[model samples]
Target: MNLTERLAAQPMSNPRADRVKDVAGLAGRSARSKRGLFLAEGPQNAREALARHLESPCVDAVYVTEDALGRHPDIAALLERVAGDRSVFVRLVTREVLAAMSDAVTPQGVVVVCPSLDVAAEEVLAAGPRLVAVLARVQDPGNAGTVLRAADAAGADAVVLTAGSVDVYNPKTVRSTAGSLFHLPVVVGADLPELLRAAREAGCGVLAADGHGDVDLDRLQDASAARAAGAEGVDAVYDLARPTVWLFGNEAQGLSAQEKALADHRVAVPVHGRAESLNVGTAATVCLYASARAQRRGADRP
Candidate 1:
């Protein structure tokens, strides 16, 4: 039977059903880890999850309220397409059921149960990625997610969270990623030293973003621009146009001395304003885009 037909035939109305509780349990790290699954809440997340499912079949099931289906026909259509040949189950649920399965204050009427999407650190490095973001002991799920989203926006190849970092599958982190979680590879529980060594072996320079860094980000950008323009005698500190791995740290403590030392260079974002410091997310965004712009400009150069 078609997904729409099946959904109509079995409308799930119980908010406290065992099945609903099982899906809702994914909000907890233990449940997500034990089950090897996580929840993708809201229309955007659902859409991205389903899109990924089409390529990889990671999604297990989809639950949506009729109101949400009506409001977001694109999601409904994608669900139907994903369920056509796969075991991806689609269920129509009441608003209460969706709310019960969600961790949001106001549920967005749809949730997708998907397997953990993290890949191995070695695999990411093996791919010879041009840009990567490594989070070392970042405790806040929101900040981690925001950095992941920013990295995706900056066209980064992957994001790696170190061993002491917050759970990337945390509900708040998932929400903060919006749909970017599905856009690039994310590696969780990575050994920072090992990953940095692997990155260097793969010919990628590692840079730590620090408030008191020795290298100024603006100067690197200017130097990169000069080289791109074929200017004579450009004294570049570090080549921003080359493959790079960015190390970001905790939102509160920033990077530890040891963590900063692991990187080949420490890059600081210039602060012209009166603000004390830039947040981790903002700093990561600026740093990543700088590398992206330099790399792109170099790639486009004759």
Candidate 2:
């Protein structure tokens, strides 16, 4: 029988229980880093965390209020699916206890204690990623998380958060990802230049998304067509279909001259509207999808 079919061996009813305090403390970075465990709250986050449990086996424990199992059949089904796993313990938690363990204003009655999702920059690069997103000193959790989701939607191989960037494990950041955090390998706290070096060594053309760039994104999109047309001098530009790593800078400051220059091309998202400019999140979506589309079209180019 699956875990859903069976009741948890123990029931945790105290909101001020010692275990509740310990789990709630995971909101802090030091606690998470030292303990090598983090909290995943809500039905969505817990479900995704459960999905990747086998690969990393990060799910240490799961707590669900009775209401949760009844309200969210999907979550109940997921618990049943992984019931045989000895590493993760599924238990019945009081609604108050679930609220105490979560940072959300309205707790979803489902929470998971998981390990930090950190991977070595070298490990992901070893796979020869076709697409990567490098977040350099991105302080805003929303922007950072949105970029990750966009990267995943664009089929990026992995995401690297530079040393000065916001914590990928921050509760707001984790929630902002909408569960995409579990969908791909995310490398955090790495030296930006070294990560760039690894991507370049893997034969990826690193493009920095700078609004004031000399080359527009539309031009880069035309490179594949130019290559097929036997056009003159157009081959000098980047081929988006080839392996690529996109470097996006901080929300307010954007990239410095040196950082922009490091990339094979400094790219700008074309703005036809009267609006001033696109934020980092919108810009990344535009750039990444542009690459995805270019690579898709390049495959069919005669």
Over 1-302, each residue of candidate 2 has an lDDT whose tens digit, in order, gives 45744564556889898999999998998998899887878888888888787566778899999998899887777788778987787889888889899988888888888888789998999998988999988999889989999999999999999888998988888888888899999999988778888788988889999988878898877776676555667754678887889999999999878778788888889999987788999999999998888777767766
Model 1 ranges off by over 4 Å = none
Q: 1-302 in candidate 1: lDDT tens per residue?
A: 68867776867989899999999999998999999999889998999998888888778888998899999999988987876765887899988899999998889989988889999988888889999999999999899989999999999999999998999989889999998999899999998888988899999999999999999999999999999999889997798999999999898999999999998899999999998899999999999999999999999778
Best TM-score among the predictions, by candidate number: 1
Q: What C-alpha lDDT values do all the predictions have?
A: 0.92, 0.85
Candidate 2 lDDT (Cα, 0 to 1): 0.85
Query: Candidate 2: worst 10 consecutive residues by lDDT?
Result: 1-10
